[model samples]
Target chain A: MAQIIQIDRPVETSKSKNVIRKTMSICPECMKILPADVFERDGKVFMSKVCPTHGEVEELYFGSYEMYTKFSTYWTDGKGALSPNVPIDKCACPTNCGLCSNHLSHTGLGNMIITNRCDLTCWYCFFYVKKGLEGAYVYEPTMEQMTAMIRTLRAQRPVPGNSMQITGGEPTLREDLVDIVKMIKREGINHVQLNTNGINIALNTDLALKLREAGVSNLYLSFDGVTPKTNPKNHWEAPYTIENCRKAHLGVVLVPTVIKSINDHELGDILRFAQTNIDTVRAISYQPVSLTGRMSKKEREKYRITIPDCIERIEEQTNGEVTKDDWFPVPTCSPVTHFIEAFTKKPQYELSIHFACGAGTYVFEDADTKKLVPITKFVDIRGLLEFLEEKTEELESGANRYVIAARFLSKINGFVNKEKQPKGLSLAKLLTSALLKHDYSSVGQFHLNSMFLGMMHFQDKYNQDEERLQRCDIHYVTPDMRIIPFCSFNVIPEWYRDRIQQKYGMPIEEWEKKTGEKLEQRLYRGTLRRNIAKHEMNQMACATQAAHIEPITGT
Target chain B: MKYVYEPVKGLERTCIRNISISSSSDTVRLDEPVDFTVKLSVAGGIRDAFTSDLWEKAWDAWDKTFRMTYNIGIKKVVAGPITKDVIKSQKFVRRATFYWSRSPELNPDYSKKIWVMVVLEGREPVHPKSVDEAKTTLFDVKKTFRVMGSDLGKGKHALKAFGKASWGRHIFGEKGNSQSVSKEITITCK
Candidate 1:
């Protein structure tokens, strides 16, 4: 329960599950709280929960028990928010959503839905606005309301949130998007990333430059695959968006919503595509599709891919260039927070999310081999982590700060083999400032030259684990001034997202009448995709010189 | 002809490598200053014999070490307006050396039992993902040395009295991992 996340259920047969920890989960059908068991079978980890009505349900919690245990080694808790909106002591997790005291991590990134409107409607996305649906209301917050939400984020205790992700059906759909970016920056939010389908940016080439000038850090552009078959949603226009962003000097993070038997096969291709455009592309955050709504067990199995499953395919597809051994879970970063907190004597930003939530590693382009070398290969990350932990302990035990600094300078090189690290990396130089000076400029510098591959499988109804909920670092800020974790905010939208948005939103007709504009006016015509087709580079992959693959997998 | 090492009685736990106390000179004059030296050597120190790589034992092994720490010291006196003698070693060590001078106030009979001891402390690290760095002794060791004075006896007797104790010898502490090893050295106070 203390970062171990004892997923419990009544053990059945001795051979079935080697039960490890016991925790609580919710029934997929009725949302009834039930006992769950987390166990290991054949090197894979699984969670089985029992509901009186739904009987016993089993699901794969993690694909690799080896990886699970490895990631759990760095399970360090975070300092909970000093000010809780709901300050109840005894814990009841997802039910207690709005900044509850039981919440483990402070907000790492606050997502604000600038508008629910988008240029294209993809079937997989559930958070966007659908025209024909009942209660199809537009939930675009006014500038004032957004300011208030940013205030809520900045108001977080210990370490106030400094980063914001403006997401929506497509944040670019809002005409005031540039102003919104400016407002977010003005509100003391240092980092602003606009989450969009990139259709608007592709159509309006100058928009990227404008947004960059407005202080937006980058575009969290949705580009699922290298081929149109795997990524039809803006596959045609995405290239133009990246080109424009490059010209504007704005960085981009390619986001692929990977679905098994669908886009999963194209993960390595997506990575290669990112590498091909490594100059402009910052990172690729591959999210395994979280299947929501009612679906048969057979159907769910087709699309379900755990973090390990994705990593396995990545290794196979990359021909073992990137392996499973390279990945470390989200909470593995907690030691840096502990070290920085100890070194700087201040509450620093920590990604103390649940170990099962996400896993990632940095990949550097080796100058000699020209192949992607995972940070783990060149750096002794585990040894460095243990050393940091020991140093933190020494500092806490009244060791002189200068002496610790001197010891840090003397011993840091022992862990990092200079010959193995990528040429021109200056790894120690970049790390020293980030840790010693507490300056994150070095981290940003490292990001510019490297590609960070991350996997964040957001929870849905079928695989909802409350333990993941308690440690959720990615959060959403409501106009009501409550900061809610991402899982509870989107997974159970009826309780949080819908409830809050509906209260603040207006019906489509009413909104149109007030704005003196038709709702369909915001819908972007496929002009960019059609125009890109007529160009000579139409046959090639977006942002690359390689040829594009035709649609084979069904849309 | 053969040296056999029996680990912590029945358990195959890590104990001591070969550690002993030695004086600068076996025989020394009363007015001459003397120094003490502690020599230690071991195979694998206190470490996690259990594989830390195994998921089953990883969590417990993170901070846990089957390994122990040792405090090696030569009990001595600090000369001052109010002179005081140390009863216990203040710090831990594997091999240590100290320089001592005759105190101005203390009479020639100032010496009692000039000895060195090893005080072991703490346990070792992870079940299997990690293991201890291989060394001779996991814990710091203690040893006591004897220099025969004019009142009692004299001359180069600095021989390890512990029978058949040499390289490949193992020492186990029955109490708190603390052991007292005494070495007798020949010194003259003529």
Candidate 2:
């Protein structure tokens, strides 16, 4: 059975004003009960909870179904995954829709919408950019308006902080793109990143220089796999190859969207590629697919892969260097616990490269001599605490400052008290110089269809900053231009639809309005969700089978 | 005020401005001549920390003859940079004194001072680059009439002595010579 993690908190009425009393989280990974507290800082809401085996549960605000589907398709295509697997949903609130109180409490908003225009047509495009859906999506933002929006945001909040990222179907398509970058620089934004397929960057040196001058901090590059046989053209919707990203001077993040059957065998190759590109590619983010695109239920099932299996594949490929035994259960509040651990066998610099086996990143250390030691076992909460305390002592004496122990302690403590989190700090700080922030590069979720379709659901929520959400600002250079937030095919309110129709001077009422129909008919019929439900039921039925996990107790 | 510089060789009373009254008929309206005196100052930019030693050296320098011959009417002239103008001798006998102002409230970090020079037309030596008569008349006179220690105006130093004078250099590093030129001035006492 899948692990059940639970989180429960007691209420306190002592304070004069309002206070978040308790929060609960159920990890779908390792089943461990965890109590958590919600934190709010600079308008962003965060949760700090740990599953005994999963490590640290540090999560950002929201994720989309569309994104997961594209990732699934890309990973599956590259990995040649053909198994009946389902990647677990990470952001499942018992209550769905926009009314999630947990989501509502978060105020910090950081997002990167690479592009709606892509070079290839994938089977599972989030925005559904395949042949039949040519007119369905329009994701290009005018350079002037985009620059203005960035300026307005930066004027409101400057960095040492987070800023929205530039993405596109591929953002490099616009000719005068460097002007937009210059505008962002004028706004004094601290961090501006690009999410791209890296095709343009690899080919154009001048573009890279202009981007640097315009203050682009990082690049999120889509890298599916190492070999062409493993990542054939039919498997990947886009023409993303490794050679294209090498030309970029900025850091690159390799995102592999894991599909069960396709690229599953290439797990070792993926890790090796990331390790080799440590100088340019700072990190590798493995995003197992979530279902939300043009893929039917049967298709999703064919590519259903979980984060656990992905880690196990890495272990198998690495010859037990990184294994389930090495990974500890990340802390949780529900019956489920997520386990995220890394091998201590690699050198400090190599280990520093960012990889998300999912439970965010957790750092572990030694107990007695106060020397830095590699974490080789899954320690209980008590053992973890003792080890951390000793590590903290070592830090106070200025011994292990070079290692990640002190920062880890602060992160854990700050996560525990979310509201009072530190200023100008990010979950990314725990990462080393070798890792660049991953753009939406994971093939599993960032497939053309997944990106297009997944982003449709987020149209209303994308431009909003952490503190407030409202109708975003847009400028119409054309007198009769229509502003489509998530492209023309997305489910928009009637008024928005009518306005666009009027601008185009098309038959106001005669133009076909087919909203959510393509999605329902093509992808949702036998969706990934149904497939996972079937798999879970099968597992439940085989209760006494060899797959059962024997719960182990600490000494 | 009388203009005099003490730090040069034997020569005194370099430049002076005097106002005189001449009457002819009784009950006749007469215009009185108004005289003006400006004191120039010269000293090392370096400050002398020891009060007694500084005073001894300063007095010795002042006793020396520092004078320039500038053809002008002189009557009851007081040569020195004005520090305090007091009502004396039934006239505004301005006391030649120098003072410094260092208010921490105004400038907390560092204090600064400005050097003021009084130029006498025609009576001063002409600069070599003084192209015109007007320019030469203005350029010739150079002396230190008074040295205002801490933020004082007018009565600071005696600028009548040419020996105590320093030539003004061009910004691009060119130097000018001090010599007499065909320059003359008419002082109409009105």
Reference contacts recovered by each candidate, as fractions? 0.00, 0.00
| RMSD versus native structure for model 1 | 15.4
lDDT of 1 by residue, A18-113 (tens): 765545567777776555667888999887777766676777788888787676555545666777877875565567687987676789999999
Tell me the TM-score that candidate 1 gets on chain A alone.
Answer: 0.94
lDDT of 2 by residue, A272-342 (tens): 55443333455556655544333443664576554455656766886664554343322110001000111
Give Cα distance to truth, residue A550, candidate 1, Å: 20
B100-159, model 2: which lDDT tens digit per residue?
Answer: 111122122312211111123221221111123322232233221221122112232211
Proportion of the native interface contacts kept in model 2: 0.00
State the TM-score of candidate 2 restricted to chain B: 0.19
Give the TM-score (vs. native) of candidate 1. 0.74
Off by over 4 Å in 2: A1-109, A112-115, A128-131, A151-161, A233-248, A294-298, A325-357, A360-555, B1-190
